[model samples]
Target: MQIILGRLDTHLGRPRQAQQRLRAAYDGGQPPAEYWAAVGARLGIAVDDPLAERLTAADIAGWLHPDPAALDLLDELRSAPVQLALLSNAPAVFGRAAERQDWTRGFQHLLFSGDVQLIKPDPRIYRLLLDRIGARAAECLFFDDRPDNVRAAQECGMRAELWRGAPAARSGLRERGAITP
Candidate 1:
């Protein structure tokens, strides 16, 4: 998921245009990888192109630069007495990349939409994650970059926050008692 954002930033190099393409794909019910490919094609780029291949590969980490804010949050929370789970609307490639990163062990359970065919903002996926984690909705605190996803999580009875950056996220988590100030 973060890799997709990075690809949009670095490869496409047009934030607004990339966001529009992503939104259009979401509206059309396409998965992230398909959406990326479609966007590339629309830009006259081919799937065989190195950038496209890297974005679509199972080792997308090679093409990704980790977001420092997300890393900070993970690092801070990993030592807390709380469970961490990752619920991502990502493809198998993203999962493969995550497994290669030993630091991702911070997450006790990882769920990807491609693996389950259940995307975010979908009520079922939220239920699935909660169930797998043995957590009640009220006991979960979810953070997402998308408003729709945050709303959906709230609808499912979990505490949801729109993550803007490290500071805001840290403050929110602290307020929720998920971490110390």
Candidate 2:
């Protein structure tokens, strides 16, 4: 089994919302993306959307906390013939955040949307992961907090798990034969 994941789910580093909160600290509290984009005058990712707001790596330095069960999950994942790949919507800074975490290990590869310049729900991103690993969609499974992303993976023929957080994910994985300890 292959595991394709989101950054927040795989590490004890800056979580998605916590990263947003850290970003908001610098912004005027209007919503970090818009607030910081304006304050820093950081250009939008797209030239057509110059007014588009964005979040930066500097905004999230040490705000992330790992879920207690995360390591347990990783430990179990490593016991099997699993290929773990990270699929997140983050920049190099996000990877750095995980690097700062002592427990972030064992993942085979990382493919970030920011690095790819394309976010999830985009089939192309899934294709990129599959192509890199030489993994077939039929044999891969994706996990994410958003149903939309899950749906997208399903459409691409990869099994998708909509993360609602802990215990359930652990239980589901156990049933899938992806985890055992």
Candidate 3:
């Protein structure tokens, strides 16, 4: 079984710009969460209170256009025996994005840390993931682009890979015996 990632699967190339704005707000002593909400609003990302607390690297991506290719891949993925899940720190905005895609069927669970008030690299988040996915860490293979988060998952006994794509994901799964080659 795999806890598949979406936004953290690849760099969307939004950080420098988001950080510039965030730095200004942070220096001005505005709460980072508040500034993030403001920035998200500018990008047409809608947020609610619970989602405000669970921001992640993807939260800064205002330029997120749906990847038709990615969508096609997800559609195919849902047909597989592998269990698929969406684990992101994105708040309500993720739901909005999902609504836009009409692709809720791709994932068995939408584990939004924003709603849960937890973020990855935090062990609690991993526990939450473990519980939501109904598996011990050993039963799950985690994929993400962040090394630190990958490390965190590893420390928790979950097989994890820093995703490069299907090849890497498949390789990691097979290497760890989470899936057959």
In candidate 3 the C-alpha lDDT for residue 24 amounts to 42
For each candidate in turn, the TM-score is 0.73, 0.66, 0.60
> Where is the poorest 10-residue window by lDDT in model 2?
1-10
Over 78-134, each residue of candidate 1 has an lDDT whose tens digit, in order, gives 999999998887665566677678667889998877677678888998999999999
Error of 3 at 104 (Å): 3.6
Ranking by TM-score: 1, 2, 3
37: Cα error in model 2, Å: 2.9
Question: What is the alpha-carbon RMSD of candidate 1 to the true structure?
Answer: 5.1
Per-model C-alpha lDDT, please? 0.75, 0.63, 0.62
The parts of candidate 3 lying over 4 Å away from their true place are 1-33, 36-69, 171-181
Comparing candidate 1 with candidate 2, which one achieves the higher lDDT? 1
Model 1 segments more than 4 A misplaced = 1-55
Clashing pairs for predicted structure model 1, backbone only: none
RMSD in angstroms, all models? Answer: 5.1, 11.0, 9.9
Using lDDT as the measure, the top candidate is 1
